[model samples]
Target chain A: MIFIVLFCFISFPEQRNINELKGTISMIEHERNDIEIMLDNVGMVYDSADGKEVTALTSVTMDIHKGEFISLLGPSGCGKTTLLRIIADLIHPTSGNVLIGGVSPKDARLKRRYGMVFQSATLYDWRTVIKNIELPLEITHCPKKERHERAMKMLDLVGLSDFADHYPRQLSGGMQQRVGIARALALQPEILLMDEPFSALDEFTREKLHVDLLKIWRKTNKTIIFVTHNIQESVFLSDRICVLSPHPGRLSAIIDVDLPRPRTMDIKDTPEFTALVSKVRNSFEGV
Target chain B: MKKLKKLLTSKFFITIVWVVMLIAVWELFAFHVENIKRTPENVQPHLSGIVDSLTSDRKINGSQTALQMVIENAKATLTRAGIGYIIGIASGFLLALFMSLSKIVEKTSFPYLMLIQLIPILGMAPIINAITGDIAKSRIIIAAILTFYPVATNTLAGFKSVQREKHELMYSYAANKFQIYTKTMIPACIPYFFTGLKISAPMAITASILVDTLQGGIGLGCLLSQSLKGAMTRYVFWDIVFFSAVIGILSFYIMGIIEIMMCPYRRTGKR
Candidate 1:
């Protein structure tokens, strides 16, 4: 009986190890099959206000997998927002191409595959919170009833259904950003591009939002590309942090965050989280 | 009573008090003038005398009382000014839309528009009068010219005031140029357009009156010129001035009310 028990215990781990390797292989294969965004050596250069040529981004090649919460982590002027804008088709790349679901960025944009939240809330002052969420739907000519229903659903998702009738100016900065997130998500786009949506909020509010966002991400299963300069924020929220260097911004390193899912504020206090943050911070050297 | 107290303490009440005080001071000066010098031709009328002229049942030219004639003339002037104001606003808005769509157009036209503003209406009125050969039509044209500058400039500024990010947001939604104009540009421009209208309203009335004075016409301007020529009492002249000033003030307030109504968001900081 002791021999049998020992053999079972010994073989269990080996079998599990094989299954783990197989799982990793399949994950890679699945990721390849479901590549949501692909940037092929994208570059952007434009004339500055003083008529001098400024290179905002160079050789920014990246593959964003479906349903992955990736962050473009960089300092100011590192072209993280620029790269995100390029992917959203808000701006064109000077060189190379961006493919979303194997099609051009512009085509993907036309198909309404991307929902972007700006650094500022960008809520129309004229629109109430619920109406602001309905803007994208209204633009797409969705039925009035559906627009209202979807807007309310988004408000509920952001835990702001109570403030649906409030205008943007009536809300705090954190609440405004929550509404912005709700507005972006209301479109039910395949991908979400957030440009430092919480950078303007206080730390307490940001932490709370981080958990809320994770919950929403889990529920929605939409791929999100968050852009931020904060290292800790990147570590706390991202599945992978794409660290970028300034002075003609380029991707320096892509760090995988192997921390457990459904991350809460408690996860931020872990040694693993701090170590990951420092690794991303060190990537900024020699830029 | 509480509402009345609030009203009495309001800015409008303060303005009324100041106006009454000025009238009282003018009446005191008129009363002190030597009886010999206080003839119909030489002396400024007292406030009471001006009031009497406005209230008098005596006919000035035809069967119309002095007050009736004044109202008729005022209505004519206001109609011309009103037509001119509408034309100015519409054309100026269109010009602003055109200029905002292209930086080159703005650069080319803005300087010339500023130069046109510098050319005084007094100088332009007679020339327009000569070309049109009808003083009434020329008066309308002069009012339009006076009203156009501020509206165009203000509307252009409003259109440009939209943040670049907001524009990008619209573009991201695949909003067409027309959609951008209607949904974003027009609503953004409302407050500025109303501001311009507030400035232009009085100018329109003043321009019409000036044009009428320069080229004799059937309006308050004609009445003023006729009164100045000693055809009417000095009190009548003062009454005309008071009525015209009142019209200008009323037009300005009307624009203000429209502004408040159309943009209720501006009233509260809750936007």
Candidate 2:
């Protein structure tokens, strides 16, 4: 009887592990079927002050899957930021349609399903760090106590609890951008749209933030669309990098990054990382 | 002790020293003039004469001393200017909001507003006085007219100065027009609004006094005119001029203090 009891105890955990594996398999299958964002031949045109029509984007078709970290990688004047803005419903596409989670971008925006971080921190100087993070919640009429709790949580996530009461002017550039990230995440939106959020920072801070961002992605598991002109940065953080060409910006290639999870800064020096970066760089050539 | 030492070495202390030097030079020049002319009439009063006129209890003409009269007139002038300044700022804020909300209104009206600003307040004072009839009301009207343009322009600039990304960020949150104004635009406009007030505050006082003097009412301008009519001594006249200048400087500092208080983040330090 003692032998049988030991057998049961040992086998029980194995059964639970099998069940957990099945649950994960089902979750992955569900995610595969879920399309978080879809763009169908989206294009944008601007009427210059001199009466000339400038094509900012042309035929940018793509699909971003659920919980995916995608980067719109390109050089200057590539309309990557414009595309991000289009996804956020901040600007209207002159042609084609953008659907976020099977609904119009406008509808999704109205529902508060999207959060955006700009290249600049864009924090209000009058508000303290925590208050700036709570801005979106305040605009949506969330209860004051709940807003405070969520802002504190976001500050913790960004490792900035100590500076919660400090003003934006009091913070360094990297810290300010961290606050910006915290603010964007405060609303707990399903999709985060970042437009070159760390491009303004120095390399050291940028690398630190990249690790922090991946950790954040792992924890939150939210769909992230990052826009950047840096080749290695695109290869580093992205699950998939969409390389775009300028002079009427258009998508040229989609490269899937098959790197390991919870990637560290050491991964940046690896041969696989350099090869991926070169591939993204090569896409920009001959265009 | 350390704080006191810091204060002694500060900009405020240096300014005081310069002002004292200027007064000393002026006093010496006045003494020379008095010695050469052998009479106080038609010449600027020395520092001692001005000080005597300021502190004396004897009535200059039939009322109180020159200092008391100057104080009384300043109260009336400041009250009118204060009322006019409030009215002008409130109206200018609304007008700026209107202009910022609609580009059509701004484009149509801004040129005319500039034209009106170009026409001097003194030039319009007579016409306003004729229209209003009452001297006090006309003075207030003149002050408001002078105060409006700078406030409106500055407020408009503040509204326009908001970054495009910031506005887009607000838009992404589905913030309405009113929310955008109150939450982001208005807070951003505070510094610029104060800048406008700084320019307009002194002008409001000057306009009130000018209209009062021109239209024959009770104020520093009236005091100056009455003194010029040989009712007061040259010393008392110089005292009134100095008092008006002091009032102008005081109003500017008051606006600056209020601005700093309203937007403390503008202050930069190690932390």
Candidate 3:
């Protein structure tokens, strides 16, 4: 009887491990199949101020996975911003469609699934830091108590809780952009759409924000679509860099970043990081 | 010693010095004019004589002193100007708000505004008096008309100057039109509206004075004209002129204070 009891305890432990492994495998499978955003041959054409038709983007097809950190990398006039805006439903593409979480981009936006950060901080000069973070919640009719709590939480996450009452003008450029990030994250949306959010900052601030952003991604697990003209920045921050070329802007290549996770500023000096950045630069040259 | 040196170099000290020099020059010029042209004290009174006129208890109409009469007339003019200023601000702001709600409205009505502005508003004082036939009513209407143009143009420009990004930010939040106006458009326009107010303030007072002079009413303008026509003492004329200048300066500063109060964000540092 004692032998039987011992054997049952040992076998039960092994059975639980197998079941846990199976659960994780299924979870991984489910996550792989769950495409957060899918763009199908999306194109945009608009009339310029001079009355000429400008084809800003053409035949852009891509799929963004759940919790993926993807960068839309390009130089000026690359329609990278156009693509980001298209996903945010700020501008409707003239051709094809985009499905965000299996719904239309418009529907997704209406459902408040997209949190956007512009190139500038875009913090309303009138509102305090905490109030700026609360703006999204206020629009959504969140309860007053909940809004305050959420804003405080987001401010803490951005490491700027001390500046809760400070105005945008009082903050440095990087700090203002961090407030912008906190404002975006206050809504706890499914995807973060950043349009060169840190491009305006100095290199040191930008590098520091990169690590901080990676830490944030690890914590929140939200899919982020970052747009930038900086090649090294794209290589440093993204799991995948989607290179775009201008002159009737179109997606040229999507390169996978195979660097290790939990990357620091130190990783930026690695040969692998350098090689990937150059490879992206060469992709633009090839275009 | 260092503090004294700093005070000597200060803007306030410089302004005081310039003012004293101008006053001495004026007194010297008046003495020279008296010697050359035999101008009487009433024609070119010295600053001290003006001060005496300012303080004299001599009554005009055997009831009130010249100074008291000037104050009374000023009160009447300022009250009428204040009411007209309020009316102008409300109408101008409402019109601009209505126009901003639609591009069609703005495009259609904006040309009319330009035409109205083109017509010399002061030249219409007689026509306004003819239509109203009441002195007070005509004065008020003229003041309102004069105050309207600056407020309207500045307000419309304010609305237009709201950046595209700000509108987009509101749109991203799915904010309704009312929300957009209250949250973004209105706050952005406050500074600009104050600018209009600063300009219109002096115009409102001037309008009141002009209309008073034209319509034969009890106001500083009436006193000014009466003095100019030699019906009142020459001291009273100079006193009325001084009061009008004071009123203009006072109204402008008052508007500036209200602007600072309303838009605290425009203030750079801690209050």
**Candidate 2 chain A lowest-lDDT run of ten:** A22-31
lDDT of model 2 at position A267: 95
Q: Where is model 2 more than 4 Å wrong at Cα?
A: A1-32, B1-10, B38-41
Candidate 1, residues A107-169: lDDT per residue as tens digits? 888888888888789888876788889888888889999999999999999999999888788
Q: Candidate 1 chain A, which ten residues in sequence have the lowest lDDT sum?
A: A22-31
| Tens-digit lDDT string for candidate 2 (A1-287) | 99999999999877777745754554464467797887878999999999999999999887789999999999888888889989998789999877787678899999888888889999998899999999999899999999999999999998999999899989999999999999989889999999999999999999999999999889989899999998888888999999989897888899999999889999988999999888888888435
Lowest summed lDDT over 10 consecutive residues: which window, candidate 3 chain B?
B262-271
Give the interface RMSD of candidate 2. Answer: 2.0
Highest DockQ model number: 2
**DockQ metric for all predictions:** 0.30, 0.39, 0.18
TM-score of each: 0.88, 0.91, 0.90
Error of 2 at A274 (Å): 1.2
Error of 2 at A192 (Å): 0.7
Alpha-carbon local distance difference test for all models: 0.86, 0.88, 0.86
Candidate 3 lDDT over residue span A1-287, tens digit each:
99999999989867777746754554465467988888879999999999999999999998889999999999888899999999999999999778788777888888888788888988888788898999889888899999999999999998999999888888899999999988888889999999999988999899889998999889999999999999888998899999999988999999999999988888988999999988988888434
| Number of the candidate with higher lDDT, 2 or 3 | 2
Q: How much is the TM-score of the A chain of model 3?
A: 0.87
